[model samples]
Target: MILTGYLHQQLAAAGVTRAFGVPGYFVMPVWHAFRKDPQIILARHEGGAAFMADGYARATGNLGVVLTTSGPGVTNTATGVASAYQDSVPMLVISGQGSPTTFGRGVFQESFLLDRSASPAALLAPITKTALEIVAPENAAFMIDTAITLALSGRRGPVHLSIPLDQQQLDIPVPPSRSASPPTVGDVPAAPCVLAAAELLRSARRPLILAGWGSMLARAQPEIARLSTQLGAVVVTSTKAVSCLPRDHPMLLGHFGPGQRSDIAQAVSSYQPDVVLVVGASLSRYYANPLAAVLENAATIRIDISAEQVGFRMRADIGIVGDAREAVSALTSAIAAGGTDTAAEPDCSAAELVSAFQKRAERAALRQKPESHGMPSVAGTISRLSRMLPPDAVVIPDAGNHWLDTISLCRAGRTGGVQLNCGVGAMGWAIGASVGMAMAAGQEGAAGRGPLTVCVTGDGSMLMHGAELTVAAEHELNLLVVVFNNRSHGRVRLGQRLDFDREPMGTDIPSIDFAQWMSAMGLRTFRIDHADQVDEVLAAALATRGTVGVEVLCHPDEVPACLRGWIED
Candidate 1:
């Protein structure tokens, strides 16, 4: 059997069922192999392939895989892969390199061989947990196993493996031993930290569990729910973790952080958590800085996988370095031993707390003019779409105003999540991700199998990945892409106008009929202008079996609620 064949078996054993990439001659053998296996999907570009794999990983918590040939293919994938790394999504990228005989020879896409100056390994080193080059054919299986394990280990992120062309075609007589399943790491150590944390919580008057992207990475949703019920705790999450608790959950006060709903920010400003139990978060400024005043006054107990972040932005009274799920489980068991009488009766019921939050949100919305002339606000459209979507849908937002709007105005449903490119705020990230997510949901294969994917992006982002729509049409993916047609990089414009007090420049983008463009690309498409058309347009778009795109004309100067204070007439 050839090395490529053995590689497939290894991936299959590790439970990785799909790969994404575009084909190139340097990796021609892989193209032939893919035809026989057909486990890999063809993508429009290398970057799109990377983001697609990222979506698959987030949806299933499985290792996402992408393949590429040499040279520009490797370079094109860097930004997407790096964004995933920052978000700590588990992924592996496989690249084909020039043959060993070509070392130092001036061959196409063989710059790595010429001087080792522009090697793919060096290029991806900073973003990956580890990057490796398989120099020998016999060592391929072991290296493959190592890369997969690293990707799944502590602080889950991406890993890179490059295969030389000839090495992939090598014959092997003996089958390499494979691990039966993917490795799991990061568990709570049996230490005094758990006891110390429990003691603090046991005597607390008010407790809160603030979750983050890391919490979801640890698959601690059920544990979060259990702990909230265990302590009558108010639950909040970061932007990426909006669905860590269900929208309708009584104890769920919604997420906190920049651009999150005003009620959560108000809650953080008014009252403090006597004992703040932060789980799986690094307390990056993106989520933690906004709640600085409230947290600084609280006695904190943070549980995270990284020791460096156990006391990230502020000092923790008791810090535990472990897996989020394991730590939460351990802490729950410890707190339970003391009894359930720890929490005092609140001033209001859980239902009342939720109700008050809703009322505040309603009042806040009413304060703002929801439309300018005929253009609907991005906030209004997002809310309308959320109401019409199923509870299991996944909503992805690209970088810019639409991203902020989703964070500020929306609440995730019972099983759905808001997946964002907040790691680096890549502009066109969500377009391809929506395709990958829909496929992972198995929405195309059968009814009721998985959630629909909705990608909310801006026009500046749309042009970057218009080609991905073709891939979606080919798969007939259960997806809806809502392109906010503002014809500018809205975030950059905000910075220029609000921060610098200067008129926007170079932020303008060529306008295109997004609905027409999507229609031309084979997706069912709709165009919306008036506020009244939102629900009806969304219904028509969602009703289509395949991929759909809804282009919404949004008010250019309508500021998101989070930034409402800085507005000028």
Candidate 2:
């Protein structure tokens, strides 16, 4: 067997039988290998394909693998890879590079093909834990192992490995030892920090659990919920962490962010919690203004799997570097051993605090009506969709103004009910991700409970590789893709209109009947012209067994006042 074939075999051995990519000249040989392998699944666009891998990794907890050609192919996949990187989702990205023969010589597709000369592998260095270029076929197996190891190791992230065209096509010997192995979890260090964290939780009168994307990636939901329950703490999630807990639970406070339903910033500042336990969150600037104010006067205990994350931005009072779930388990064990009796007598005021939060949420939900600018309002759409779908339905939103609306309105009672693009905020995430998620839902009996998978994307987002609906149709995936047809980039248009004090230019998109287009692609379709008709259209779409697209054409001028305020602030 040749080196290229052996590499494909290694990918298969690692449980990544499917490989998605956009072919290019440099990757021709590798593409041929995948075509002959009978395992790899080719995709249309690099970005959409990589996101599909992300969804697969999330659902199965296996290292997702994707391949692409150098230059444009690799560049196009930046957003999705960054999303996986930021969220700590394990993924392996193999890209074909210009031949080593073209090193330093001006050649086609030779943009820094070797030494950080604008290569996608170099671009990914800052975001990824490991980035390597295999100039020789012999090093391919070792590099593959290292990349896989790092991707599945502490604080999982995407790892980039580039193989030069010459090396990939070479008829080099395939070493039997080159076979890829299943990634193994390493040792867990003793967590004395857990004892310190437990003491802080015991001493604090008011405590809050702030969970993030890592919570979902690390499967730390149960551990986090247990900790919150034992300490009588309020549980809140970031925008991307919506499904980290059961929203209907008494202790759950819903999402906290610019678009979240609850006034978490106000609550955090005014409520003055004595302790804030943030687990698995990277503390992105979008999540809070400074985070220091939110944690001020509060004993902050940060638990993350990576040491690099400990002092990255928000300084932790007590930093514990290890698996979030394991650290949480240790903390809970310590707390239980020194248990304080809170169960015998309920804290009267704590119950009131929970009620107050719920009341505020209900009031906010009611007041979040459509504000007419001209087109359909994003917030109103989200609220409407929230009402139409079953309480446990999964809402996967692509990044954009529409995402803001969905985050604010769509309510998921528990983890796995709702998923969002939290980390890198990629635009085309929902459609592909919804496909993967819907397949997972059906296999897991999500439909038996009610409506399963739903995707809401803005017109711009929908136009970007929306053709992936073919994948859905081909697979007969149970999914609904709800398009907010504004005929423009709604968020950018609003920014230009409000901030630039001018009508949007270059942002407007040619209007298209997406439902009709999708229907032609062999899927059920619905187009809603009026806001009033949204409920019925959305309801019908949810009930469909196969792929369906409901296009809601709204005036592009319509913008949420809250969003406008956010821009101003």
- In lDDT terms, which candidate is top? 1
- Give each model's whole-structure lDDT: 0.79, 0.73
lDDT of 1 by residue, 325-358 (tens): 8988888898888776654553345546656776
Per residue, candidate 2 scores C-alpha lDDT tens digits across 1-569 of 56578677766676665566778888888788886532455566888878877876776677777788888888878888888887778888888888777877867767684554676666878877788987766666676667777888877889998888888866655456555464677436356778888877877777878887777877888888888778888777777787787666778776666575435556556556778898878787787553567676788988777788877787888988878788888888988887785323333465467668776665666665554555455677677777767666778888777777676666675576677767677778887777666544443232223346778887787778787777777767767788888888877887888799997798879978888888988779998876677667777777777777888888777755346442122
| Cα lDDT for residue 45, candidate 1 | 96
Summed backbone clashes in each candidate are 0, 5
Off by over 4 Å in 1: 35-38, 113-117, 172-179, 341-351, 362-370, 446-449, 565-569
List the candidates' TM-scores in order. 0.93, 0.87
Candidate 2: residue pairs that collide: 112-117, 247-413, 375-555, 376-554, 376-555
Q: What lDDT score goes with residue 244 in model 2?
A: 88
